[model samples]
Target: MDIDRKKSTYLTLGILFMILLSLIRWGGETLQYLFYLRVPLISGALLFMLPIICIYLLPSMLGNLFVLKNKWRMSLVIPGAVATGLGIVIIGGIIGTNAAARFNVSPCPLLEALLQDDALTPYLFALILAFPTAWAAYWSSGPASKEMSNTDRKIGVAIGSILSLLLMGAIYWARTGETVSWVSDMLLMIISILPSEARAGLVKDDQLTPGLVTASAFLAVSTILYLIGLLLYRPKIKKDRWQLPALSYVLGLLLIFSFLFGLLTFVLDYYRVPVLLSFLAVSALAYKLWKVDHYYDIRPTPTEPPKPDDFIGALKERLAHQQGRRTLVVVCASGGGIQAAGWTSMVLTGLQKRLGKDFTQAIGLISSVSGGSVGTLHFLDRFGNEGAPEDSELNAIFNASTEDSLGATGWGLVYPDLWRFSGLPFLHTQPRDRGAAIETDWKSFMKSPNATLRDWVDPIKQGKLPVPVFNATIVEDGRHYLISPMTFATEPLEGLEFNRLYPQHDMDASTAALLSATFPYVTPITRNSEEDDSQSKVTPVFHVADGGFFDNFGIVSAVDWLNEQVLPKRVELEIERVLLVEIRAFPDEEPLQTASRKNVGFLMSLFGPLLTVLAARNSTQAQRNEDIVNDLKTKWTAKDIDIFDFKISFPKNIPFFEIPTQTGYENIDQYTTALKDEKKAYTPPLSWTLTKKQKDAIRNAWEILNQDQSSSVAELEKVWSRK
Candidate 1:
């Protein structure tokens, strides 16, 4: 792809991905209160409306004010926006359900909170009419109506004026209605986390003061200050006129508001804020210019060059095929987020380090899923040139893999990205979707600029870079979606051929890496469609979810290649021995006794089957992979060919120590004390980013290698030594 096309694809995907994320955010909150929690019908409707207006409508409206070149075109979009807003509840509920299962969260609080008199009932009818009425009134007079005739605009202005007065009257009627408690709690929480010196009047006699001077220092809201900030935003007027942009004050305030919201949703679990907070006028105008314009969408139309190739076409030039008699290797990488990423990279690095030229020369392809794909992508990034040792640049790549993504993504979800959805702040901001944020951050965090996906095409075909196949799942059709240097062997495999389906687009290298890893609701599901296909708007948009949903261990596709491609056509291609390597994040499965559910409630009855399915989604696919491996070994063992399976499991010994003890506590007091004293086990976090401590824990993984891992490495070494 030319430079312009690449940028366009990135911008388009990035922006749309951002928009999808905000929708997800709205859906998540909306679904939580109205559907999942199943609050009273009236109360639920009250809870659901603001997320649509504030999160979905407000930002888009403000954004359109500057972006919509044809102000008349926006009228067409309004109906879509309103329809989309209403449709969000159902679509959002599906996302919520999937996410709830993945994260194992239950958002409903005690009945008292939902049923409280002060919660929502008194202001119910007024809010029901007021919010939407205000929305309509604003739209008629606001940016969307700018192209209207003077007479129409004046009439709109009149209606808006009357509605604005009525809204003030309504506000007076509901004076400080849970607004103070909600606002005070938010302030106190944010202030408490700040340094004492930064939080003046935050506490007196060990009690928090909920006044303007306390709770949050960032709350300096003023239209005049904001305008002054923007007026002085010019960098060219005096490049060093000031170290800090005057805009920082406004941004600081906006950021505080978002951070507090995140605190409520994820950390505090405090959702007692009387349904919705009225829109803040300052917020609507604050980030209007903070848009991710598509040139970088400079018409940022990111796309890929067409170097699409088929599976056989890709394999023709590999040294292993040319050699005719040497053993060929295909590796299967498992899915376990970054933990799996670290482990997969380590295993590959060890192979290259230990086996040297033999390993690099013998390897044919790496079939990877989720985090495995991420790791494999990293390895392949620097492996484009054979002049460099295969593992030469791996240290940097490995460190890049460990850099923090979840931190930025956590905030990205609520704040900066939510405001504009498709476009970043003109300054170039991170995306809010977990997949986009991680992929975006991951790419930026790379020590050096990444070579694009197509950059490796020629080198791969010429037998320089090894081919790595990452898989995602088709939501409509449960098939493996391949993201690889060469497209899949579609004749043999029952899956989606990505390059074939979308020939014109080039996914960002970061996006390609994480496409397989965006498990559950961590990121927006990919929707593939053409820009001009208006019919696609109504059709069920094609969805591509995390590859792990179909095959957490990437062996299924690897085995399919052996079964349908390699074995059937061995004579046409140079026949050789096959060595299949399975690298897993988990230890071998052990049978265990099942626990009985003592009680079953209404929610349980509804979701029990759904929960069972979610829990089994990975394991079932994993077991199928194992079965496929075993079947291949059995079926091909006596075939007129050679085959072997090597297993490298992540060390069972993580960072922490464990011991089996026979002794038991004698009494209730002793048992309770023992439980309290017990340390939290060192389970690897399932996040896109890992901290230094987490990395440290994984650093010694190979050192504390389990028997299976040690044996596999030793055996591979022995085999290579003889070869």
Candidate 2:
């Protein structure tokens, strides 16, 4: 109780200290300008405004610093602010220089003199006072800000002071040795303070133009609407009270004003300005409303934690429900999913070999969008809900090949090759209506055991179209030739010279023979591979040859086969598992020029820059580093597999920091009693966790180690070893 009170007192002191630091800096800046520097009162007043600007920019500056810690946005805000400031200063300097040139006198003679001063005594003193003052302001404010580094905070304060002084000196010099024209002084002051207004030219032709009247009317109306919008924008139970509708109302008014102006311009034969502004107003408003609409379409939030149970217990509970069934595989075309499935199949088949054919039944595949093709698909399909499968009967899921052009093309080639390589007969079961064709009925075309191999193979073997066949054939020569064998559902290529363009030149004899045999029975299955095809054309050539195939269509059939045939036949053992793999690739290099060696090198250089950009974007240096540390930490605690941190551990022996152990504390009751009685020091108690056994052990150890029933080193050690 005493310790917690002390902690609370310290926290209060820390906050007070922070507030004191700001006050001290402000007082010093004010006093130093007035007494020590002996600057004119007017100059001091303007210099004081610098501190307010510094304060106003403080929050954004800190927020910018926080973003800096993030690698993706690091160094952005500081560099952008510095660039903007430098650009403004440069432009100001140039304008001053040009003005002085026009007057036949140096506008910033004092600045030049100061820069050339060998001792720089005055500027040194100015810098000294400014730097520390700025540093003090920033130090107090920085931790609360984004993108702020300690060095930057100090530099920012110092830079702001120096620039402020320089700008003030320039203004002072420009105003010297004059009647101090009141109108000019006021105008110049307004121009300097409200710099954005300088860009607003009302009467460029030195006349009261209709455009000027229109612009004035527009600004007046906008100002009124803006004030109304602000008043309308209030927190409310109804969603309609939001700013979007208020903004829409204001914009609608603006649009009406613009249309009126545009119509007037057309009536007066002055069309350009009104027409452009009207179009811009409508277009900008439409775009903003669309953006607001997009923000409302959000994915569902994640679910709560799963029940406490062992794996088998959880599985049994889930399966007992049997709400629905689905198949899971790592991927359709990849080695990992296939390998895992193969091992399971081997085990199941071994068990079933003894039981004979019908022992296993009801197996099916659950087709998934390939991870490589589109990572967001699973997240989107499930609306990003990641939890234990709600449906019980789901048996398996397979992550398949992301379909690319090469994969699709490769699938086409595989159909023809499969007939020659494998003996699986092709089955064509197209519905009478092509538009309404359903993939589920495909099994109806499967060859009966009594059907002759020759009869089953004839359709594809003869290259006959619109016929159910086991193989596809094309005669290229007078001698009967089978260019590429294909299946019953094969879509023949028109005007494609078989075995000519992109010919099967790279296929090994074994692969070719294997493909030829099985190709006759293999048919193309479409899956959601849209994203893969787009990426394939640009890079290391994402293709079928690269083992990327999308099999959404095949998945339905595979799952059906699993649920109906494989499960009943005991041909495969299945366990639900998640397929995890990282799919990333660098962008394509530019095609080399064949004109000359130098040309080819130049082309490579051109693409080299682009490749570097691509590599940088794909690299997750910050995320990867943090993830690696977290991964190790997770592994240390044996929680790496969970990926989510659902639990935290606290040592049993560690003394609660809230308890007091002061040596002179004779009246424990006085301090603790005061805490609960007089000062109202108690807050809601924090929750903790401990098993009954651990708690009992802790109590026993505490009693055994501490003879006086007080905390001791030995007692603490015993408690520490509980875990």
Candidate 3:
């Protein structure tokens, strides 16, 4: 066959294969829903094998059959016989079912009905259709005398098109009943899953007339077939490829317009007028500021005072001595869901295990957000209490706290009766206060009571653990707020006051941790009294949510602190490279794209512009982060600042661990034993601890750090010789 003909044939077969696979999957799901079939092994194996055979193997085999001259006759005969047999079985099953129903006769249960009662009809029909298409191609490829005439070829194409249309009609009829419109059915499915508020304007009633069903079904089938025909008979590929660019531009515009419309609708629907007007006002003000080239001058907080007794001064003096030389290892944790906490803990534990006690000592700063804060604070507490623990001890601590810290209870919300009835509540909550239950539980587990900021200050003063800084975002102001122990540790401690320089007030460790990790919607927003009463005398409280709202991973903050604060102070013997270890929890999949035709996919596409904006913003932020790092790298080539970004995704379908509770003092020993057993089993396999992607990241970072260290030593030796 010629290249053009071969290409056309492959394209046709590929489309057919995709359609068949979708039908097969839909059929299997429908069957499972209609009749609770438990053929897990059989269904899984068939679902896996069908795509390989139909899409890949069969296409290659058919291509070879068409190309081979002499072997074409035999190839046609084999497929023809298989097709004939499948057709017979399908027809026989239909006939037998009709006859049995007409005669009021039932088939024997033991003997069974024709090949599982036509369950394989869809597959058989797909195979049978392929045989005739292959035969037509072969006939067309034959010698001049044997080749089909123009009229015959036209008729053949018409017949194939008609058959495809009919098949689609039949599938639609089977999927949606005579009294239900397919579009309405789909909308109903979406409505069932959507929240109560979103159900407005959607078809609430599923009732539809037979005529409407038939018309809608026909329209739906015709639309699908038209699209398929367009794909098959698409305009020929031109050398200039002028159409490609135009097509892309049009699609891009459509996507942008759709996204904007969706976003505007959502803003109007959710926040109503005042918030939207406020946002618009802000945008106008920002635009005016930008026009004057003074937008960047609007600082969120006042500049830091040049006090030698401040935290930065303390850090500078501590690192002034050569013996006290340290690398300010700033660990930025990424926010995902509950899995983020687990992954963060695992990453930190792994780092400590591989790099040893010195690694812990070198880490002078730790900044985290949401789930990352949970893991960071947990590790700091453990390290302070137990020093640099062995691998086993670290693993045990992680396992024990992983469930309570990352589970639903960690959100400080009470679950419904069903959740408790299913014994999931124990894993998530403690018997104490319902709100901030996770914080209470964590405090109890650590055997530490909630202490004022002064308690934490003594440690940093004595050079015990690193200065822990957690981040949260204020919703109303739309600014990133940094919470640290030092920020709250005032000399003349009086009434709580929000400092203009620090922009954060002193709170207990539990509240600080909870505020830092308070994910929006999941955990309720925290309301705290502010010292400044200028705004309003009635309510002078600030609302704080998850730090992820402003900076999800703490990457930008880490770099900013390193350059603007640490480097300028000339900390360490000579400021060495600022190493950033970011642990991400999300998978390495393409963002914002969803499969077509799915309800969720449809919703996502409708709101595509919002996602696009978010994606663009993230990309820009990442570029800015890289620019900052690159700037440091250029200026401090000797120190060699480096970044190691690692992501560890949670394994699919892993069940949450269950925790045991005590009934009374008599069963305390049993509960304790069960808890130990649970902890032991809670630890997943080593393979699950770190994915290959994460391992590679860790290895690369280790190599970079070692290389820089070696280079620094060589430079020092040369300087010493000169001296």
Q: Which candidate comes out best when scored by lDDT?
A: 1
Ranking by TM-score: 1, 3, 2
Give the TM-score comparing model 1 with the true structure, all chains together. 0.57
lDDT of each: 0.52, 0.26, 0.44
- How far in Å is the alpha carbon of 49 misplaced in model 1? 29
Best by TM-score: 1
Assess the local accuracy of residue 286 in candidate 1 as a C-alpha lDDT between 0 and 100: 44
lDDT of 2 at 475: 23
lDDT of 2 by residue, 519-603 (tens): 1112221111122247544211111210111121112222222233333322122332211111111111234455344434557
Candidate 1 per-residue lDDT over residues 537-577, each given as its tens digit: 43233567788888888887788777876667666666566
317-422 per-residue lDDT for model 3 (tens digits): 3333324334555677766544465567766776676555655565666777777776666676665532344555676545533432222232122222123322
Candidate 2 to native Cα RMSD, angstroms: 28.9
What's the TM-score of each model vs. the native? 0.57, 0.19, 0.43
lDDT of 1: 0.52
Candidate 2: which stretches are off by over 4 Å?
A: 1-66, 69-73, 81-200, 205-723
How much is 420 displaced in model 3, in angstroms?
20
RMSD of 1: 21.3
What's the best-to-worst order under lDDT?
1, 3, 2
